[model samples]
Target: MNIKTEFSDKTLTAIIEGDIDHHTAKGIRETIDLAVEEKNPSALTLDFGNVQFMDSSGIGLIMGRYRLMKLLNGNLELVNLPEHINRLISLSGLFSLDIIKNKGCEQIETRE
Candidate 1:
């Protein structure tokens, strides 16, 4: 899996590509955590547009990040989720965590 991060106006966007399984989750988590610590963004967006597959580890990754953002009084958004992954997230009860969804053209305000 490849993880690319973009920081703008205190918002850190991590565009994740490829499958997220146990093998890749550790590296992905470390990368994202480091970015979050460095940027200290008030919001985070995990763009899963290119993610093809995910296992339970993916859910753990998301949950962990959610906690991290909450601790910093920030927010976490999940965008461009493929239908299968969306179902997995929903089935995992992750929706109750107040994960923001980017639908359509509505942009997420990062700085102001």
Candidate 2:
């Protein structure tokens, strides 16, 4: 997978592309972690809009980031999730903490 990062305010946006599988999840995790450590943002946005395919590894990757953000007292949000991917996240019970959105518009309301 390819990761593109952008920052606005204190939020770091990681735009992930390509298939996220076991072969790629580690690099993604490490890259994002490093970015977070360097940027020290208050929030992190994982843009999955360009991700073509995902498996269980994707869930693990996201959960890892969620835990990392928790330790930092920050937040993690998901943007531009496809229907199937959204369903996967919902089924995995990850939507409870992560905000899943479409076209930069968030459908899931988060209260914190």
Candidate 3:
């Protein structure tokens, strides 16, 4: 998997590529965590436009990030999710916890 991160004053966006499974989850998690710790963004966005496959481990990664963001009193958002990955996220009930600002598109503010 390939992970690229962009940091702004209030947001950290991760552009993820390739499959997210047991093998790739650990590295992705660590990378994002490190960035979060260093940048301290108020929002975290995971862009999955280039991702092709995901498994249960993906859910774990999202959940972990959600918790981390909550601990920082921030928000977690998902963007550019493919259909199958969206289905997985929905089935995991992640939308209740994080914002799905866009699907395969740029992020938008959900609140005024």
- The C-alpha TM-scores of every prediction are 0.89, 0.87, 0.88
- Encode model 2's per-residue lDDT on 3-88: one tens digit a residue: 88888899999999999999999888888999999999999999998898999999999999988988999988888887667768
Question: In candidate 1, what are the lDDT values of residues 1-112, reduced to their tens digit?
Answer: 4999999988999999999999999999999999999999999999988898998899999999999999999999998887777777877888787784846523332333
lDDT of each: 0.88, 0.86, 0.87
- Model 1 gets an lDDT of 0.88
lDDT tens digits, residue span 42-86, model 3: 999998888989998999999999999999999999888877877
How does residue 75 of candidate 3 score in lDDT? 91
Query: Total clashing residue pairs per candidate?
Result: 0, 0, 1
Estimate the TM-score for candidate 2. 0.87
Q: What C-alpha root-mean-square deviation, in Å, does candidate 1 show against the real structure?
A: 7.2
Candidate 3: stretches off by over 4 Å: 103-112
Please give the distance, in angstroms, between residue 62's alpha carbon in candidate 3 and its true position after superposition.
Answer: 0.4
